[model samples]
Target: MTELPFATTRKLGLVIDLDTCVGCHACVVSCKGWNTENYGVPLSDQDPFGATPSGTFLNRVHSYEVQPDHGAAQLIHFPKSCLHCEDAPCVTVCPTGASYKRAEDGIVLVNEEACIGCSLCAWACPYGARELDQAAGVMKKCTLCVDRIYNENLPEEDRVPACVRTCPSGARHFGDLGDAESDVSVLVAKRGGFDLMPEQGTKPVNKYLPPRLKDVAPQIDILAPFLEPVSKGPKGFLGWLDRALSALPGEDR
Candidate 1:
């Protein structure tokens, strides 16, 4: 079995905003594209065009209809991936020592070369983040775009994970969570970010912001009554014309 490091230099992770996520699945597509093209092995698809399509994906989004105590039902888009927990159960449960958490960045990863496709890591993960690539016959999960993040050849702004870079809604943020003053940390603090499952004792580095409640009732304009016409009858010119018509033949005053 593998053992976790005592500590890590930095807790690099993501901050996702549930209020802003639109369930577009851009992150999923980008993750699949980048990993298949550049990462360890290409993700496989079985009967992709046929009825029953099955494939390996590192990231997935789930939607739910939640009804708050005092508000209407709200559709929530939740994106799930590896959390890179400080106490990663997947690492310790690996019989072949293939799954390990990085001591430098706290990023949990699988050594595909050493993986035996036992699916122990997948079973140990509480978030269901790991997947076995049928083509490579190896376990695969999100690496936080390790290749892109540390590559000196890539531009500075493009160093973030493909999911973060491709999120059109700006719902994803990545940085060192260990720091008290990093942008991602501050955002988490300001937005009251929370862990996916605190009871599991994984101490996941990633945080998620709760969706802001939608207003239950529309706002009433205070000046609406004042904007109404003072009189229901015709105005000055029309009143005169009415009086004149009333005085004509067969007209009543």
Candidate 2:
């Protein structure tokens, strides 16, 4: 097993807003486009024009339906990626010293030259953040765009992760989570950002802001006026049921 240093000076990561994420996979596409050329692996695609096309991606977005007892169901767009944990199992479980965390910025990185494609890191990661690049025969993951973030040639404003730059909804934020005064930290504190699967003990650097509260009055209005039906509308139990079901949460689904 591998081991990490005692601590790091900074924890660099992302803050995702569940409320603002519009289920756009721009982050995923931007990540695939940038890291394929900038980083270690090529992020190869298995079958471009075939029936089943799959590729190694560092980012993914998932949509889910949430049904609350008092309010309408909401369709949540969740974006996921490497959390760059404080105690990363993906690093410690590696038989080879290919995986390591940076002390300067706390970014988890894999050196393809040293990796043996053992797949141990993939199994060790609870978030499924690592992907095996068959062409390179190595495990790959998000580098927090170490090359781009620290690049001298690129403009300072363009130094952020590709996903952050391409996000149309401004749902993603990148900053040093270690600094309480940082913009990302302030947003987390204000929005009550939380970790993913906290019980696993990874202490993920990336945090997710929960969806904000919404008004449920219109949803509850279905039962108004003693469930009375208008002269022009359908009557009785069927009318009540129709209104109730129509006003149910996640109506767009």
C-alpha lDDT of candidate 2 relative to the true structure: 0.91
Per-residue lDDT over 127-218 for candidate 2, one digit per residue giving the tens place of the 0 to 100 score: 99999987788998999988888898999989999999899999999999999999999999999999999999999999999999985554
Which segments of model 2 are wrong by more than 4 Å?
A: 217-253
Clashes of each: 0, 1
* Candidate 1 local lDDT, 1-253, one digit each (tens): 3799999999999999999999999999999999988878888898999999999999999999998787578999999999999999999999998898899999888888899999988998999999999888999999999999999999999999999999999999999999999999999999999998899999999999999867666678877877977788886999999888988899474
lDDT value, candidate 1, whole model: 0.93
* Reference-based lDDT, residue 181, model 1: 99
- In candidate 1, position 93 carries an lDDT of 90
Q: Quote model 1's TM-score.
A: 0.86
Judge candidate 2 at residue 227 and give its lDDT.
67
Best by lDDT, which number? 1
User: How high is the CA lDDT of each candidate model?
Assistant: 0.93, 0.91
